[model samples]
Target: MKTLPSQLTPFVRSDAVGALLAETLGHPDAEFTLSALGRLTGVSGPVVHREVTRLVDAAVLQDRMEGRNRLVRANPEHPLYAPMREIIAATYGPVPVLRAAFDGVDGAEHVYIYGSWAARRGGEAGPFPNDVDVLVVGDVPRRTLSAIAGEASDQLAVPVNITRASREDWDAAEPPPFLRTVRSRPFVDVMTGAVHGG
Candidate 1:
């Protein structure tokens, strides 16, 4: 797994730890098995285990054995819970937030996060991105998409820009200049963690 830049998640020992924390703390009420978290974060099992062990030791996470599977969740009682949640929410919340907001909107065929945010998430070295750029390829109305983007912006404390395109345009026989650019660059699928391009 590629290491997350320290600037992407300051104060974390490694990118794996930051990602693991994002999955666990981002959904405080949810409990995840270590293997599940490993898959979610794209971290290997041993790395996930090591990081979870560290967090458990520090009381940032609570873990228990359920037969053979270990379930882990954020410790609400941890003094750093709120602050850490805030940090993770600001740094790594966009994926889950946008995914939840636009995953299965009627008439939508694909949702992508492009531009600097996606580039950084794909492990590029750069300054922090101030806004998130999203491309929707489907028949969803622009007004509805704008409203969703507005809500997601508030939740993420960042501007969420929406670019709408019809499925026809997306699958054009001759792709537009803009589509060519988007296709050549790194972007993340909101419903899936797939990253395309560099």
Candidate 2:
């Protein structure tokens, strides 16, 4: 897996820094080990450790010894913590935010993000995406998805558009044209954090 695009964090040296910040700052109350953060952000272990150490050295993150494991968490007391957290929430916050929104929603089997936002996260160069496009594969009702999208939009500060497709249509020998296009470009699995296509 690749890191997020540099545009996501203008001051950071690598996109991995932004991603690690998203995990830590985005969930301020939670503590994570280096390897756990790596898994969640799709970053490799060495990079996760290096970036985390840098943050800790800069006082952006706080870490403590926990037996043989090192536990890391956001340092809310840092002067830049609030503003940096807000920036991360608006940019990299969609994955966890939307995943939480759709949790246990009946009939929503698979959720994906496509279009410009996904492309940018996949490291493609482009203008900042103004909205998020979601594809839900299952039998969920439109009204339900619309409501979810609305709330997600409010949380993310970006418009969220959700389109649902039946399992039959999604898995068809000849998928719908829309599915074909979505599968031909960069899209992300909301649950697994996997990137597919370009």
Candidate 3:
């Protein structure tokens, strides 16, 4: 998995840990078992278990036994809960939200966030990106992509622009100029697992 930017490294252990924190701590209502979190963040179960143990020891997370499984959630009562949530929100919020937004969208093979926001996340110095640019590669319908983007925009408090391309277009041996440019820039894959170094 790709490592988070340097600025986020002190607070975030790894991309998987950040994703787990973002999903659980960032959203009070969200809860997950170790396996579920692994599935969501694309982290292995052993890794998720280790991270969860650390967070639980630090009082950042609370885990309870439920039948054959352990259900984990953020500890809202922790003194640092609010601030920690804010940090996770600022750094990793878009990912889970985007994942949720496009969860069931048919024919979406890969989803990536490109352009300014992605660049900023990749550690380039600049003013914060105002809007998010999304590239959806698959055979999804434009209207469906638009609707998903609209919902994500409202949820993230940022404008979202979506661009679609077919699998063939995205994987063409000699891709078009736009595809080449997109592939050349920094990007964050929000679906089908993360790819490091854009």
Candidate 4:
């Protein structure tokens, strides 16, 4: 099968350097250059510059040359960067998981969390082999779902099981989508966050 596209328009998206740049954009800030931002975010310098430019165009950041160095600052209360940062964290930090899921779903749009792993503090237990149960909230493209399930199995070093759930069906429970009891140790860990590992 064809590999999927890398870029995605997620609920929250960030320029790779978004966090590093934000740290310096505020007043009374510490010094940070493109090189510094790259190092901080683990992205390359050129990538940081390009993303910074986009942020500037969106009026989220301001930039100028300050005697042989480019200086950047968050546009005073731009209403964009702050929220952008939050959105990026909520949206992107889970990306390693989400991306794995997305790959499994192969571009299917209707996946959501149902079990303990969905909890903010994580599930009742820590990460475990059986806690990785995932329910596809909508019709996941078979290929994507397969890919994500495989990645989760391999990279997470845990076993993950996939279930199909319609929007109405998945949300019917107290937790909203976990109607079935967990079976595998892998799945149990996923729900409990007991899988304890990436």
How accurate locally is residue 156 in candidate 3, as Cα lDDT from 0 to 100? 74
Candidate 2 to truth, TM: 0.89
lDDT of 3 by residue, 1-198 (tens): 344543333447666677788879866876788888877666677778888999999999999998989999999999989888887776667877887788888898988888877776565656767788888898888889888888888877888899998899889998999989888887878863354345
Residue ranges of candidate 1 with Cα displaced over 4 Å: 42-46, 168-174
TM-score of each: 0.84, 0.89, 0.78, 0.36
Q: Which of the predicted structures, 3 or 4, would earn the higher TM-score when compared with the native?
A: 3
lDDT of each: 0.83, 0.86, 0.78, 0.46
Candidate with better TM-score, 2 vs 4: 2
Off by over 4 Å in 2: 1-5
What CA RMSD would candidate 2 show? 2.0
* Strongest candidate by TM-score: 2
Query: In what order do the candidates fall by TM-score, top score first?
Result: 2, 1, 3, 4
Instruction: Give one digit per residue, the lDDT tens place, for model 1 in 1-198.
Output: 545554567577776676778778889999999988876666788888888999999999999999999999999999889999998888777777887787568977888889998887777778988999999988888889989999999999999999998888788878899988888888877665456776
List of clashing residue pairs for candidate 2? none
